[model samples]
Target chain A: MSLSVKHLLGIKELNLQDIEQIFQTADNFKKVLQRPIKKVPTLRDTTVANIFFENSTRTRLSFELAEKRLGADVVNFAASNSSVSKGETLIDTVNNILAMKVDMVVMRHSASGAPWFLAQHIDASIINAGDGINEHPTQALLDAFSMRERIGELKGKRITIIGDIMHSRVALSNIYCLAKLGAEVTVSGPPTLIPKHIASLGVKVEYNVKKALEWCDVANVLRIQLERQHKPLFSTLREYALYYGVNKSMLDSIKKKIVIMHPGPINRGVEINSDVADSKQSIILDQVENGVAIRMAVIYLLSGKREME
Target chain B: MKTLLNSGQLNITLQRLSHQLVENHLTFNDTVIIGIQPRGILLSDRIVKMVKKISGNQQLEYGKLDITFYRDDVASRDIQVPNDTNIPFSIEGKNVVLIDDVLHTGRTIRAAMDALLDFGRPKKVELLVLVDRRFSRELPVQPDYSGHTVDTILTQKVVVFWNEKDGKDEVILIDKL
Candidate 1:
């Protein structure tokens, strides 16, 4: 079966079936990656443009690699070096790219809901990479995939998202995704770093790191977005590390081992200790590997929508 | 609709095909059996079983190949979900028998062969089919061991049903109109 939506704008627009379809597709792509000849000719006739208004390493490269692996012609656009700096409008920039015969767009922007706005004005399908404090759908998907690989089914599994809940697009998307999969989610961090009224999203809030770590099966520690903060939210990185950081000793104190995860560019000793991030329980690297597969699945499913039209 | 081969005839043809395979690849020491995905798997599964039984070599190499990624008409048709490609053993320097239920356009075999080469270079490759739609082939490809052969028009279709999937073992030719 195909995905319900044409564009993967956000997890909020996805039903449970869409998520399952993507996971199943990714399973096939994962096997393809393990072969001697890892490339496939599925998208040989298609072209995709990757437009990043924000900076990224893992997500952008992962999307580019997925596109190349599927044999799609890719053109990369970086905002820092583009005409956006010359006061060109978003619509104008995208129209020029579309004129070049691009079939799809994978975009990350500094403004929230940028991809949604672009989707309304463009004929090409849009995949939201990350928007300002809004949602990172692919990151959430890869996180869930990694967790499902480690543990069996996500239903009734406890997932604790620790650190920078107020500023993380990943946290919002993960909450939406995990909720649809019937998983229990707990948002844990310092009081200032966590958003008020977060319980409206149907998640438990925990201010103490140790108690939160002890209560979940998976701890998806998010990076502290120092760049996103315009005002002082937390006192200091050292204080945050001392109070909210996930260290090996905190995990060792728990009765059973819990799966550890991070969407990278990790603030090594700040949100997660070096030892904890590299420990046996950590699946940070697996999340990166699955990112390529997940992006491939998303791109392939979206490209199939073209034939239906 | 017309019945080409009933359950009794299907059984005899499968047995004969298996014997023919054993005669060529004695003990299957260097030969690997691979089933093309979707429908070809049904014929290949039975043929593989019989070949193993006749040769008395339970460890014979076998795999299932899905050519969806290598297909040339991906964007022009419906989205085809890929089946599992489980070629655990390398096909390098080995003989590979590509088995299918029907050989019609020869386009699928072309795609299947391209998919097979990605694993490793095989010494020799051959086609095995349950039914050969003789004159309908768009390409110059033929099966090495065929159970049955029929001349058909382009508008007609050849369908094989297995008890495991279709609740019977039979071959049927259907007129489109």
Candidate 2:
């Protein structure tokens, strides 16, 4: 069966089966990665354009690698290098690229709903890498994948998302994903960093970091988007670290060991201590590895939709 | 519909195929048996079990390979779900026997070969199948060890059912309605 929706705009748009299908497909892709020659010829006939309006290191490279591994021809368009700098509209730049016969578009933009906006104007399948603080679907998928790999099934599992919930696309996407998978979710951080309406999403909010850590099977720590913050939300980074930072001593205090996760560019010793980030319980690198597989699964499934004649 | 091979005949044919494999690759010293995923694994699993029972070599290297990622019609046709590909050991420089349930257009075999090569270069490669639709090959592929050969029209289909999976051991040919 195919995905009900052509574009993966957010986890909020995916049903449990869509998420499960992606995970199942990613399982095979993960196996493919373990082979001596990891590349496949599945998407040899397809061409994908990565159009990023925002800066990215891991996500962009992961998508490019996943596309290449599937044998898809990839063209990268960074806004800094492109005519998006010279007063070109997003539509104009994308339309010109679409004219070159791109079969799919994977994009990251600072503006929320940018990918959704592009999806309306283009026929090619659109995959949102990250659209502002709205969602980062692939990162969430990989995080869940990594979590499922470490722990068993996600259903009935307690997952606490710690750190900057208000400004994190990863946090928003993960909450939706985990909830759909029947996992109990909690968002924890300073009250200023956590969104006011977060509890409306059916997740518990914990101001005490240690209590959140004690209540969950997994702790997904999100980096504070310093650039996204317009004013001082917290008194100081040190105070935030002191109160909410996940450190070794805090983890040791928890009765049961909780799996630590971060959607990287980590503010080391801030949201998560380096000691904790490098700890054995952290499946950080596994998430990075699974990111390629998850992106491959997304692109492959999306590319399977027959091109319009 | 016509029965190609009944349960009794299917059983004997499998025994003969297993013995033939053992005769060619004695002791399986440097030879590996790989089953094409989904359907092929059923035949391969039985054959490997029988081969071990007869040769008394329990350590024979056998693997399951999925060729979904190597298909030529990936974008042009309906999407096929991928199965688990478990090749625990390397196939490099080994005499490889690729097993499948049916050899029809030979496209699956072609894709399997492409998938197989990605593991490493094999010393040699051979094809084995339970049923061979002799005249319908779209590519230049033939089975070295085939249980039964049948001639059929393009629209016809050959189906093999294993007792372990389908609750029966038989082969049937279905013509276009």
Candidate 3:
């Protein structure tokens, strides 16, 4: 018998088959989008609480949209506006929500592995939207789904993830997902941010952007280390852009079929050139659209309502 | 009713249905086939192999769907069993054929259709089933292709077993205890 995962706390909990299931469900869900009324009654009366400890617009909104589209009742819990500021612990807040009989919890916290911690304690199905720089499984799933849609297959494809590898959860999640889907993943950035031990996860590390670009089928340029700039991680943004930014010339040297991708709120002139961001090969928007479908698939599968259709 | 269509006869029907699926040209240009969970998924795999053999192409993608959440019976069932709905490939803009083992009251197909829409829009969707047990369907649903149609009493249970579930492929009609 195959093990069924109730909570999507981390990608580590999912094997190749589990990931494939979600992707397949997402494929079917995508068909509903073409209908006049896109909403489905699959999750009716199921209450989903979005507990975001960190401030976010895209991830939170996408989850909400997914929940709503699946006919679930959604309750948003913004940490800043909640009782957390009143000296309440994360566990206490979650326990209070659980007491209300919420069916599932989609949480985002600045603390790493917060979702995993909650999963150990809560009966409610847990979906980690983002937990610090630890992991973002859904983001990685959507990225993979988008890539599969565009590139046909992930097998033997070379994917170069450039930028702040150390702090970007997108990079971490993508590394796991890309490797699982049989893509040859490479991470490129300054030596400080690109850890040497990352290759343990079946990813090759490259410090030279040009070298990585030449060897890649897809270049996923990450945001510059602006949040960590004061730590003296890099000399300056200008130097980082010149050394690592996916500029027009850098794109020109690669295969014409090479597609560029980014997890949004892009620092246009920083990590990627403006012209390249707007280029034909860029699938940043496709990622956003795929995000909704992927999130919907996640919520539906985890709901655990198994009656014969 | 129990002896009318035995286990061995069911396997023969599925084998014949597999041939019909190939003959009907029921697949897509960029074919991505999915099976509704339990029996449907097993039948789908068998059909996938047969389809691949007929087309002489090994590139066809197959997936499984567990339409538990989408079922109309959710309100009535007190106990639920969660199964792995595994579809590893993307169905977007591809021709998707939803396969099932039996087509009964049409509720399962309705639920499966609802669940499929959540993934992504396919270019087209076609339904294929191993058995179309003629019963009063509550919904206006019909299979594009069927392997066998049996007229049976509503209380007669249709049980389909594949090599993955049981040791062999067969269909049995069980009288309710």
Candidate 4:
């Protein structure tokens, strides 16, 4: 199925069929990645802009690589280094960039709905790389792609996301993605970190990480948002580790080997143990690897034909 | 509207092509058969088996290539799912035989040529197509080995159905609806 939407604002805006089509296209692109010549000329004539309003390493690199591999001309704009630091409005900044014939914009901002707001004013397609605690659509797609690769169909699969659900864009996107794809999703962490009325999204709530791990096929753990939290000391790193940390011991307790996933910049012992993250059960790298292909699928679908330019 | 080759005729054409390949490169030493992916894969697989049988060469290297990304119309049409490119060994100095089911626009062949160049330079390259549609050329590409020549317009599509996977072997002209 062809993607009808011009901008991939968020997973909340997408249905199950749209996500599956992205996965289906991603499946083919993954094979292309395994070839001797990894690059494809599909997006040869298109151009992409990666506008990051926040600091990032994985998402930026993953998107840049995906765009480059698809043969699109890419330009990166960091808010910290760009005119956004000089008090330039996002509309003026993006419109100035689009004035130079930029075809698409993949932006990651600290403010919630930054991408949504940008999409309203831009003529070019806007892909929400990450927008505050709102959504990271590509991450959700890649996470679901990796899970679907390992465990056949995502329908009825048990997955529990552990860490700061309230602050994580990954958690919000994953919950919507997993739920829409027919997974039994559960959010587990300190009660304070869990989003309000999250249970209303139809996900089971679990406070204990051990209980969450015991009852799931995949543990999609997120890093604790320490830098974002300061005013209210909900839980210390030492205190969070005792309850939510996914270590080798906790993994051993579960008879069935569950897949471990973390959307990078891991807080190691705080969110999940290094051993568990590096273990055979860990598909963290696979998630990282799939990130590029998923991004390519998203970019290509959204960019449309080069002649349309 | 017209049938080019029936099941029996297709088998005969493939056997003849296999004989021609063996005659050119005896015993298949320093030769690799690479098929343009998605469709040409089956044709190459069939030809490789027949060539192995005819030449008594069991160690013939065969691979599949996808040229979706190398197309000229990438800017014109919606890019669909790409196929797998599997070439395990190096093609440094080997004589490569590029195989595909049909030669229509010749753009597929051109893209395949570009895709193949990413792999190490082959000593020589030969093109083989099952059905060569005459007079509708977008690129200046001609097949070195061809099964049958058919005249068609821009509106018609030449479809080659294999016996093993497609349940019956036949070539039919499908006009645009």
* Per-candidate local distance difference test: 0.94, 0.93, 0.81, 0.88
Q: Clashes in model 1: which pairs?
A: none
Query: How well is each residue in B1-177 modelled by candidate 1, as lDDT tens digits?
Result: 999999999999999999999999999999999999989999999999999899999999999999988888877776666788899999999999999999999999999998999899999999999999998888899999999999999999999999999999999999997
Interface RMSD of each: 1.4, 1.5, 7.4, 2.9
How many clashing residue pairs, candidate 2?
A: 0
Clashing pairs in 4: none
| Off by more than 4 A, model 4 | A31-36, A233-235, A305-309, B164-167, B174-177
The per-model DockQ list reads: 0.62, 0.65, 0.11, 0.43
Selected candidate, larger TM-score, 3 vs 4: 4
Interface DockQ of candidate 1: 0.62
Residue range A1-309, candidate 3, lDDT tens digits: 121677787787788887887887787667656555688787787899999988788899999999998889999999888789999998899999989988889999988899888878877889999888889899999999999999888989999999999888889899888888899999999998886699899899888988998888888888864664458888888888888888887778766568889987799888998999999989998898889989988887766533222
Candidate 2, residue A2: Cα displacement in angstroms equals: 2.3
Q: Pick the candidate with the highest lDDT.
A: 1
Q: Can you write out model 4's per-residue Cα lDDT over A1-309, one digit (the tens) per residue?
A: 357677898999888778877887787678768766788777787889999988999999999999998889999998887878789998999999999998888999889999878877877889999888889999999999999889889899999999999889999999999989999999999888997799899999999888999999998999877667766746468888887788999899889999999999898888888899899999999999999999988887776633454
Among all windows of ten consecutive residues in candidate 1 chain A, which has the lowest summed lDDT?
A300-309
Docking quality band of candidate 3, CAPRI definitions? incorrect
Across residues A276-298, which tens digit of lDDT does each residue of candidate 1 receive? 99999999999999999999999
Error of 3 at B96 (Å): 20
Q: Is candidate 2 or candidate 3 better by DockQ?
A: 2
**Model 4: per-residue Cα lDDT at residue B136:** 99
Please give me the DockQ of candidate 2 compared with the native complex: 0.65
